[model samples]
Target: MTLEAWAVAAVLYVFRTLVDDDIPLNAGCLEPLRIIVPEGSMLRPRYPAAVVAGNVETSQAITDALYGALGVMAASQGTMNNFTFGNARHQYYETIAGGSGAGVLRFGERGEALEGHDGADVVQTHMTNSRLTDPEVLEWRFPVLVESFEIRAGSGGAGRWRGGNGGRRRIRFLEPMTASIVSNRRRIAPHGLAGGAAGACGRNYVERANGERVELKPCDTVEMQPGDVFVIETPGGGGYGAP
Candidate 1:
């Protein structure tokens, strides 16, 4: 049901956006649109189906496809950067921010207008719309410390209009806990549009207490011992114009 709604919304949103037209909620704009999905398809899952995993990846992929078909922009970081960590008592989950694809123009993560072919930087895009939690609040509640959280500068693709930049987050566990990372764009880079360049792929790893570094898979849970730090470097959006 979630995907169904999202697809419908995407079509309406993209239809108006391509021509820089305003969207009206009245029947004049929506009356001609029709959405039909076959039973039990990926978009319309049967009851009792799990959607968390599908929701994150499929929605973003769908939106990217929508825009790609219109040739208006490039692809954004396709994952929600889902992060979750917990022990027997404490728990935390968040969808970290990343770059949005560069179009003829785009806004900053804060909604400010940016020049040329640059997309928004370190902002929430696509299906990963969520608030960025305050670091102090996290530290106050959890047994972990936020070592660093900032933009992975220059991580965006280079183009006539550059792709937006992704972000870097490092959290050190003060106690033993379990941490899981579930995301995409780790292997395949976000695609560019026109004569633009492809964005950088995302990366995740752990710096163990013993100074050893270990890479993590797309979907994996790891034991975080004391002094171990988990780092997430999200993917940037793809550039839309020639470099």
Candidate 2:
């Protein structure tokens, strides 16, 4: 249902420029569109089917799919980069930002001047525009240290309109707890359009106190002893046009 809502909005966004009539939030806009979801499908699973990931990761995938098919833009980072850590007394959840696909406009079109447009870095695209907790606030509340948070430059696809770059975040644990990563676009790269290049895939891992690094799967839950560092490299958005 959420995917359908986002898809509808995306379609409207691209078409609004060609039409003169206003498409109001009410029936005037929504009535023309119909959404269907099989009750048993993943989009609409059975009761208590554990579809929490659907809200975060799967939702973005659906939007990415829409973006590709509609030719509005390239794919954005397909994951929310959500992570959670908690002990008996405290729980913390944060969603990291990523790159956004470059703008979509044909040459000589109304927006032709933006042919060299590039995707925005460290953005929250398609899904909820969630803002991460301030590093100072996070460190003050949790037994964790914000080691680094920076842009993963060049991670985006190359094109006339280059794809956006993803981000990197590393957090060091100061105490023992359990941590989990829920994300996607690790295997499949975000696709490009109009002969553009595909975005780079994301990566995740843990660095133990001994400095040994262990790669994390798309979804993993692991124990984190004191001094362990968790690093998430979010996926980059796809390019919109050929370089």
Candidate 3:
């Protein structure tokens, strides 16, 4: 199992423990629990095989399962966890970042999709509410550089209850750097509720620091060298409640 799945499992155990005794007090607390996994998922690993999409896909499946079990809200826009690794001080340094899902409360009585998706927490579960201030730290430590990093203006889906904003991050490298992405919601738009619209899609791009560029899809893992930059646009949150 990947670290993300393991973390979820740990949280589940803790949540059960905390509410086991108090469950009878609140009927709402007695929802059933289930785990969702795509067939042949990495989470279903056997020592012999590995699935590259396991990390991000599994996390998303689990999140959807949580929402369904609770009978509380629609699925989240989706999760994004793009990773980058490079050599720094003769050692390897890595970083993972992504966007957040829409909130259930935002949807009115009739659930709807969000116009713009919001960013999510990092792997550590910190909500993607803010921005990363500097790429200099990563550059100083690793064989990478920051080309451009900013929020994608007007990328948010418009609706009665607008969706959250996703971010755009660009990274350049002095040497070849490895990248792995765990992102979704490109095919399925961020759902809305109570007369709202779906959110915009997430994307990744690889381009030269100077002129040419290439766009990468979700779950794309590649290598980059000097003068090449990787741009990651995070997903946004779904809109809530009708305007």
On lDDT, the leading prediction is 1
Superposition error at 40 for model 3 (Å): 7.8
The lDDT per prediction is 0.84, 0.81, 0.52
Error of 1 at 32 (Å): 3.4
Candidate 1: regions farther than 4 A off:
16-30, 34-51, 105-116
> Once superposed on the true structure, which residue ranges of model 2 sit more than 4 Å away at CA?
1-23, 36-50, 105-116
lDDT of 1 by residue, 1-243 (tens): 587876676666566565455566554665676768677987778999877675677778778887877666788988898999999999899998888898855556874435545788889886678996799999999999999989989878888788999999999999999999998899999888877788888999999999999999977899999999999999999987778
Q: How close is candidate 3 to the true structure, as a TM-score?
A: 0.63
List, residue by residue over 110-226, the lDDT tens digit for candidate 2: 534344468889898866588999999999999999999999999998887889999999999999999999989999999987788988999999999998999999899989999
TM-score of each: 0.84, 0.85, 0.63
If both were scored by lDDT, which would come out higher, candidate 1 or candidate 2? 1
Higher-scoring candidate on lDDT, 1 or 3 = 1
The lowest-lDDT stretch of 10 consecutive residues in candidate 3 is: 121-130
Query: In candidate 2, which residue pairs clash?
Result: none
